[model samples]
Target: MMTKLGPLLLVLLLAGPESSCGDNPRYEKFLRQHYDNPKSSFSGKYCDSIMAKRGLTKPECKEVNTFIHETKNNIKAVCEEGGEPYGNLRRSKEHMKVTTCKLKGGSTRPPCKYKENSSPRYIVIGCENGWPVHYDESQIVTTVDNADLD
Candidate 1:
């Protein structure tokens, strides 16, 4: 169960000090969070709008990003999912299921292309009020059982 966060764990491990942003009493809040539930229908312009709003523009476009589809409460519960401390952050752990989007095309300007990678993984997230509030860091209190994928 906890082993699922492998890929995401790797990302957190490599994340630099200034990777995420937010002020929700726990983890930094995303500039523009969106619901990426599997059943939802998103317009083709989804990335175009969100990228700008999140300040992911300027210089070069963001190469990769992720969207969680679960509720704030459900996400927070991940802290108790138990794994291992990701970094120096307090009370954080890895969760499962995320939609990762990678920039496509060679251009870094407008109309940035993107490819989606949706899967169940061990995601590193910061939690507050018994829920997850930000990503990129946290601590855990569990051990790995298996490295299965969903």
Candidate 2:
């Protein structure tokens, strides 16, 4: 019995920490981390202040990240009927403005300097029960005619 249960436990363990049973706490954390919009306009200080204030660079620097300039309701619509299924993620039908922040080379560790660039993009995200659980990536919609757009 113990031997049989061992494999079952292993499979469950291999599934990792994410469970789509309910509203995941990670979804809220994702919102907090990646969903801020510029009030006036994005500035040179945007990434620096936002990242540090949001605690992404506290213990160590995050390698890369993006912030979407839209409300949660708009982002939530990506998982609805309009979203295209791309593997385990849903791709947004509408384009959104996003700012990509990359860690600057040779920057001090604690200070974790970043360079930012903003662009229009369609986002891919993982959703369960119509709520976003993961931010996949921002995509440039080059193929408006292509059905396989991801």
Best by lDDT, which number?
Answer: 2
Stretches of candidate 1 off by over 4 Å are 1-28, 34-39, 43-60, 80-84, 89-95, 127-133, 137-150
Choose the strongest candidate by TM-score: 2
Worst 10 residues of 1 by lDDT: 137-146
Model 2 alpha-carbon miss at residue 55, Å: 0.7
Per-residue lDDT tens digits for candidate 1, residues 1-150, read 668898788888887433443445335444244334442455755555555556666666777777766654455555665534455333324545566666888787755666776665666665465345566522222434354322
Clashes of each: 8, 0
What is the alpha-carbon lDDT of model 1 when measured against the actual structure? 0.54
Query: How does each model score on TM-score?
Result: 0.52, 0.72
Which residue pairs come into collision in candidate 1? 4-122, 5-122, 22-28, 22-29, 76-131, 76-132, 83-142, 92-139
The root-mean-square deviation over C-alpha atoms between each candidate and the true structure, in angstroms, is 14.8, 11.0
* Model 2 spans with C-alpha error above 4 angstroms: 1-23, 38-44, 106-108, 138-150
